[model samples]
Target chain A: MTVSKDDKWTEKKISRREMLKLTGVGMAGVAIGASGLGGVMKAMGYELLEDDSTTAQNKVNFYGPHQSGIVTPVQTHIYFASLNVLLTSKQELQELFKQWTPLVVRLMNGETMVEATTNTRVPTGDTGEAAGLDAANLSITVGIGPSLFDKLAMQHLKPTALQDLPHFPKDQLQQEWTGGDLCIQACADDPQVAFHAVRNLVRAASGKVEIKWSQAGFNSFPAKGGTPRNLFAFKDGTGNPTDVQELKKAVWVDNGWLKDGSYLVARKIQMHLETWDRTSLKDQEATFGRHRDSGAPLGKTQEFDAFDVEEKDSNGEYLMPDTSHTHLARKSGVQMLRRSYSYASGVMSNTGAHDAGLLFISFQKDPAQFIAVQNSLGRMDKLNEYITHRGSAVFACFPGVQKGSYLGEALFNAL
Target chain B: MKYKSLLSVLVAGGVLMAGCGDTEEAKKEDKPATEQAEPAKEVDLSAELAAYKQFALEQMDQFLMETEKFVNFVKAGDMEGAKATYAPARMYFERSEPIAESFGDLDPRIDGRLADIQEEGKGEEEWTGYHKLEHALWVENTTAGYEAVADQLLADAKELHALVQTVEVTPDLMITGAVDLLNEVSTSKITGEEEIYSHTDLYDFKANIEGAEKIFDILRTKLEEKDAALVTTLDEKFKAVDDLLAKHATADGGYVSYEALTEDDTKALAAAVNQLGEPLSQMGIILE
Candidate 1:
């Protein structure tokens, strides 16, 4: 526990083959031999990364110009946790982020979080739930909330665009789940891997932060891989900004330490499944103004056909109802990158209805972009009948990692 | 009628004798039967249905009376009075909404939110309900050009009363209604956004709880027979929630503003509702 925190880089960087030669650890007996040599390296703040070429398909690069999770192709599962900073000092927060960087790398590379110790007296460094699992293309994204600045006395460093969201007309936000000081979003094709990332991260920050709230979500991709439907069974992310150029314009921030970072707006929108299940198929289609089965715009043949919001029907009515969700969202004209997933938490304790809805996540250059769309969604969208906005938050995601430097290192050094 | 009753009794006796014949072999073998056969007793649910209908009709009558008062206040341009009357009037309708919603068109005309009929920016002409009146009283702060809607609201309230009289109530409907009432409140009212402009969601919340409680009260005797423990706990939970809500009642017996309740208060209410909801859901299965 009293080991030096920063000594690995000073020592020689040994290749895995040399390390294995120096200390006989092979693929078959790797688990048994982990405690002997790997434990020592780990205690010295180094975890050996073997060249396992088979894992090439299962790993996402941890160091990039932009974080991997945001614009990376969406994963099948997510574990999003918003934490309340328990540490009072900025240095503590900075050190925690530093410690997390390599662990994230190891996890994404499908390597053990820490050396496997044969010692049974002490708690295992890793939970070992994902022991035999591959990485499954895991990505972990970290972010800081608006309240974090005040806590660290770094309010002057706060992004101008990072503010608490304004209350919409129909918003009924729950206090317990609404706000946090920091957030971590972990995504993976495998649920266990996703949960493992968040679990170990939380474990690593044992005394520095406490989970304010967390939600587990999942998505089912078509065999050919296409847009997935939300709990409402409508194709979501249909109109998201997908191109890197479009992302730069609409998602990635362009100034300060957050130049390559983006703002995340998370909303826990609860779908009233019981009520929705009772509604007629026609009424359901009319509510979203899309054919539920095809997910096409009203009167349109293709799902991706541009919405003709103003086109008139034979009856002189708008082809899509003006109060429809897509029309209003399209009217806002504020494009953001959506990476939402559906979630179901069994029956709501009070209502006896399915506690399910979209864990709505969107990335943008500024929170104002999301606010504009939400303002447009204010009381008039017919979709409001079957859904309720129960929780909301805003966070400024840290810029991508550079090798040898940790997350948010630029911002901390600037100060 | 006497002759028919006698004939049915004879037929029932014949079936009972035939049922006894199956046991003759066992008696001849001197094998002791595990238990004696009990006569099948008929449970008439018509009395419960009639009582539930009467209760719904009575609640509608009160709803119509309140709507009349609400409309009068709107017509006189007494904005404050109309606003005060708004949520209280909604209580009667919300309490009997399961039956009121049986009339599909009437429910929308009477309780539809502004979102139901119009676009985001445009004023809605087709919308007419408690919410439309709410918007006029709270958001617009005037009742001008709302006279026709007020008139129509009263007409609908009366129609709902008449319509409810014709609705067929069954044990199953009562059970479903009890569960749905809780769902309705938890989904919308508990958040205190159902009456967004007026902040009068507490009235609706209390009404919905009481409405669900009414069905429980009607069926408590039967439920006690099936599962006494569940009935006992549900009764206690309802009382606890009602006691919590009682703290927010104004001097005139209307609820306090939804905004006035503290976060702790809201959480306590939610916790209580959840406690009652679990057992309330079990009612459907047990009654079946």
Candidate 2:
């Protein structure tokens, strides 16, 4: 998978205008060999590194101050994969990242992982499932897990805050779903595009890594478009940190090799739909501490209307039940950016119940923010009866890649 | 049965009325009437469904005995012995899963994987089943802490066996049960996810196929009467799947470890199961 350092295209810098023109021509059924596409990409990579072009249809940039998927407005779908590293050395791991950087750019550009090949004898470089689809706002974020540090013998470089989460009460975590060496959180408006990004990336790293466990999830927005409702029929992500300053304070780390990067906490929470469906509508609303139709705090009329968690009614009873999910979470007084997707894989074969839930993902400066909120939910959150934490993982997502440099370059430089 | 008989009588009356019309028109109507009457000779499925229930009970009987032996091995802290008996004991339950699943919570308690309980939003402490012991034997490589789980597994198996006797097997259960059994194979068993640590998925795979095949066998005579070509297709597809599975069989009547199969072998098996599944899924509609 190594690209030769002395390749002619690696040295040739092309202008964005010229590169777009050439790629546009190529897109119109021009026959380019696999190597030819690689060369063209190397040249285009240098030009597109500085700023994201507004011209590309529904595209997200590969290079930025922070990773794309973290605060990139929630997409319609996510294909999150946790991978186990098979590589033995840190140098080999570094090489794999270098090999992936340009490919990531190509996918976000709505281009195939590699150009279409005329040779039918070999499997296509790209799986070609997402062919002819636009970029669909695809964003790929990569992160390193705690186990990867030990595997590569670079424990000293591991972040102090990045470690396995403590077992929360009632967490029924499974080994297969828990930890991973690394993670790729690919999200896009189109399900196939999100899936294609992860598929091509994993395929490229074939022998070097394998998916430990992966889940595909989605969020369906209303026609008017607002916070998408989870499977529980409550508008989620309503309380996420939205403003730039709040995002900086809560999400992006400000120091060390991880400056501007964030810690990603992923919890695979399975929501029992059958039980929830049996409950009354009023109970469902009380369980979430919000109106089921308006997504507002209890006793409020609008989804974003402010209300104190401790607000009491005229009768001196708390308006928002203290045991409610939102009340407990707000009492923690910490916030993390929630970018979650709901999943409905199929029914449980034995009981004929739905096998569905939320792929709960959050980004925080330190994982303690998420931990504090989860601890606040604790054993008493009314929502616990309908949900279980099945899988959990935390990863130190790298700061965004810079032009002429690859992913995780800061960490390697520190070493 | 009453509705069908009434429908046939109405058709016979319509045919008699046509006999009062012109001779050529009556002759034309007579040929169509006989064609309609052919289906009126419908095979009664009650006896076949009853036979299916009996088969389910027999499987449950064998399941209890095998589970007891497996439980005893675990209680004695015999890792090798428990591991050896684990998948074979599970085979009986897999073969009659549609019947066992009908009983409330028993299927999950006896056969639930760790993920299954978690998906049900249950706590880990509530996970008392065969896979719990399977994890202890294979992953932990010690049955020392699993004596209680072993006892619970046997008790659940016994309860399931007892409950099977009360299950009323309708034609719908048999028809959909056959399709469900095949689906169980293609979805999880084919991926070797059911027995993650033990890698004895092939045993469960074969058992599910046999269970589905048993239902098909009982319904074969009636199905052939309705669609002979479909029955032929199903027979050929089932044989194709069986032939592929036979290559992986061991002399001890067990199967090769699921992990031992190559990528190509797994794909080939998946393809065969899918081929069989297409025709098998139609059995319900065809029977209706």
Candidate 3:
């Protein structure tokens, strides 16, 4: 499926009310309150509302109950940007989201941010780097950090469950990489597409926001296809909940303005490849408590075969070592969706060591689910010796946007 | 003394006899061996390499002394004193960076920045060096929490001083080290990423150029013997870079804060460095 240039030109003329009607969301559904409606309405002038392109290949629908990139099958590449808001008021923040709504929709539909203009004297509307690329199943997820509330004086609207992650043992968090007022998680099958989505969005919002820190990451799948291996060569994301019902229970927030929204916890974990490479295959397998080849539990044969962490051999020894990463994580008795990617930036200038690690991202209904599991693995997991947690952030990702409404409209309506 | 002179003359005659024997063998091959009649003298670079090692050791010694004095000011909670010493202290390290980087892990332990440590996925505790203290003194505006960092900076400086004596400086090292010094300036120092908080990047910038020039000076005679035009171009280019840097120099033999430079100033400096770097990169190939 492909969208021709002529189709995009006509779609730009579709009015907001017409767009809502086309998407089956009646006028009655939008309940933007009186207090912040003016700024949101002003932002409406800039909106380029259009239906998701059905003809576009590998496209994810923009309108949904929950955001894409969370439950959407993991993409091969990600370009995550943590930004600091330069705006002052809550109304301005709402306006910024409203402004971003249609731009994001256009990006997911595999179209440029706006129609091409013949005027060559000025800078182009969209950065043309992603011109020849498809949507590549691109997903853009935006979330507000805990600090954003205090900055905008909207602490009352902030979720009680949304806060920064507590420092765990062996955390070497650097301030430059740690906190941010907002974050953009752009993922796509093609890295250039993912990076282009972010680059264009950030450029569109130039002075209003600045990137505090960002890391680009990727995953390589086997030719036949399966779970991808991390830098340590162990299959990752094996324990993620696959059932829709389980995903809903584990991930989606159920109440308040944040209903259907989930918490995102991002950790910049630096894996010490030099140390891991020196260990024997047996010891390496013991570190993750999974076979390096098949990604199975120690006593299990298949990749997905489940086994009890407490189950012991005839010798009364636990099959999975009590100190293994998977064992402790399982012992926590909680789950979250792990959507992570590996990053190899280059060598560290001083030590000549590879500057590589996992950009560990997880989605959960509450941040506590992630916190509980991390606490369980605290200091005791053998994996701790080979990894260092260098950065951390938690953000309350908004629920998906319905037609005629903007991103985070629920928060503004509650205000 | 008379006996030693006689022994040296005997050794010189034996070397002459060996050369004649090689020339005779070449004649028997019946090829046009006119060039081999008097064997072309090999340019022995051993003396130059030894001279470069001595210069590097001197730079390391100065780095240690200045770093100790700077660390003392930091540990005493003297903010102004520490800030005053900071840029001057880093000058020595910047000058001797090639030799300092030769040792495994020592360079990073003593000179690593916050970003460097972050890249290694290590904690803030692992970050110990001049820049770490530079952050506390300049950005944070206090030296209260960096007591251990100050002590470690001194210890690492001492280790670097001890390590320099053991370096087996070679011709390749001298050639490459010159290029590396110029690269350090063009990449980080020009951008003001180094000395980010203090804005004293010009100090390090000048030092790197000086270090690279020292290498060129030692190899000047050998370089001229091969390519005299290249040697002349290098001399002029080096002077151009030095002249541009001289514009930013302060009365105290220090440089103006990197932040004080206008966009035009930086651009001109960058142009001069690039001009020098192109000709300087050829030194290795010419020598080989």
Candidate 4:
């Protein structure tokens, strides 16, 4: 991990672009040899950089039974954009998806969207901002919104449960950050890498799509990985399922073109910091039904202590208040894999409150799981007082790719 | 968070200085580096601060008068008048809320929401503020037990008026406050949730915009001298939002009912707020 800039192993591991530059190989030769280069180099016993703790340098596998970003370890940064499809015809939309697949693959492999072309008069194939950088563990997850079905005239193919979320009590949802025809969630260890992934994809879809709304979010990485905190300084995503089997039960969809996929529920919850900041510690703790410092459930000393909504104190009062966020969420018994992150655009210009909140993202096998939990929290959750659900949307995430197939290939084929 | 940021900056500066030391040492061994960039000019903000102080005081004076009127309406048991006057009265407070909020416990006492009190597990006796008056006027539909709270509100408004005269209106406050006003609208007011009980968020929204506009007005000359293009963009954006807001204006100049607004109207206003906010946020950095 501490390998110096001039290390021998670093020098030996020549990138494909570097290899082309050194050998003066033409584009055809490079393209033909692209898939086999790693295998060929391995067979020739050429030792490159060791597969170790270089998380930022390592390339994540884009093709799998399920998308990488869904259940993969949460990256430090994310640039999630929901784009409205400009193309009306199914053919054009499918073509855009087809064009995006190879680019997504190249980016995830830590390569530029396309190999650099020697045409000075024309624009470069790749944007070149990420030219000198690694892939930074980039993972791009594409999703289809409810409106996309109308555009493609594929309503029959839509998932049975794929629909807009119900408006909850106290929801002041803004339209701009609400819904879109399609969404791309890009996550990476480096912020620039995550942003670059979305930028290139959006650029590639120039005429076919436009950004409906986007939110950039981040999670601070402690030396040891653990749950991150929301803008309210409370540990969020602590209850998320980490086991693969548990994730499969709670997240992966089982039918249609979305098989092995998941449903993404994104909510832009604006935390009322001005009011929350004025709140007493006792009230704040009561609102959460957990200890702020340790993130432990009331009447428990550890963060992971099983939450008992019915537990009582010496005064015969409920230790975990029924209205507390944890109590209501726990009582609902609906499980989803939460992968939320905090975001702050800046201090809102209208009010002095910090324009910050959790970009609450959750994935489940069905949207009902998320809805059930939200419904449980709708009218009674004490945390509701300090937060507003300002944005809401649901997207049907596509299943992962096979070795040669591109993203959402099954959906394209079905259409 | 501020301490952490400062520490990080110091650490980064140390690293940069160390790198420069090494490079300069090498350069001295070869030849002295030529053509260093000129230092940036520093601008004085005393005049701006003085101007903002005057603006804050004037705003507070009007806010005091309005709060007294609201209190008087509540005392007279004029429920409809109180309801109608509620949001407009909040305008003065909203315009200079950042400065008002600068005084610990003042804003909460005067403009705190019902959730603020209820969340704290306090009963009506403990909940003392405009929101208390609001709940009484709207929810209870009577001002029976709010007499004491009314007097207290009037007293607090006067306190705010006196306290504002001595306020130090720094450039950072104006810059941050301007952006904060926009964020306030985007976060809660635009959603019509800011004045949820009364549905008078339109008034708060207008006042916040006016407050932000006032800051831009005071700093316009300075900002223009620095970045004329940004000032021009802000001017167009401000006009765009104001033009849209004008459609909702009543005969009395206050906004129409918050419930009267359509989703499209809110959307249009929010877009304009963002359009203005993006460039307005740059003012602070420029001033710095």
DockQ of each candidate, alpha-carbon based: 0.01, 0.01, 0.01, 0.01
**lDDT tens readout by residue for model 2, A206-323:** 5477788999999999999899999999999998998999999999999999999999999999999999999999999999999999899999999999989889999998899999
What's the lDDT of the predicted structure labeled candidate 4? 0.80
Candidate 4's C-alpha runs over 4 A off are: A1-56, B1-288
Off by over 4 Å in 1: A1-13, A16-56, B1-288
Interface Cα RMSD for candidate 4? Answer: 19.3
**DockQ of model 2, rounded to 2 decimals:** 0.01
lDDT of each: 0.81, 0.85, 0.84, 0.80
Error of 1 at A253 (Å): 0.5
Considering the two chains of model 1, state its CAPRI-style docking category: incorrect
CAPRI quality level assigned to candidate 2 from its DockQ score = incorrect
A best-first ranking of the candidates according to their TM-score comes to: 2, 3, 1, 4
Cα lDDT tens digits, model 1, A1-415, are 1233345733456665465465444322222332321233333343333332344567888888888899889999999999988679988888788777778887888876766654432336687898888889898899999999998999989988999999898888998779899999999999999999898887766546778899999999889767898877888888888877898899999999888999999999999988888899888887888888788999988888887788888899988888988888888988999998889989989878898998999999999999998889788899999999998999999999866668888789878
Q: Model 3 residue A325 lDDT?
A: 95
lDDT of 1 at A239: 84
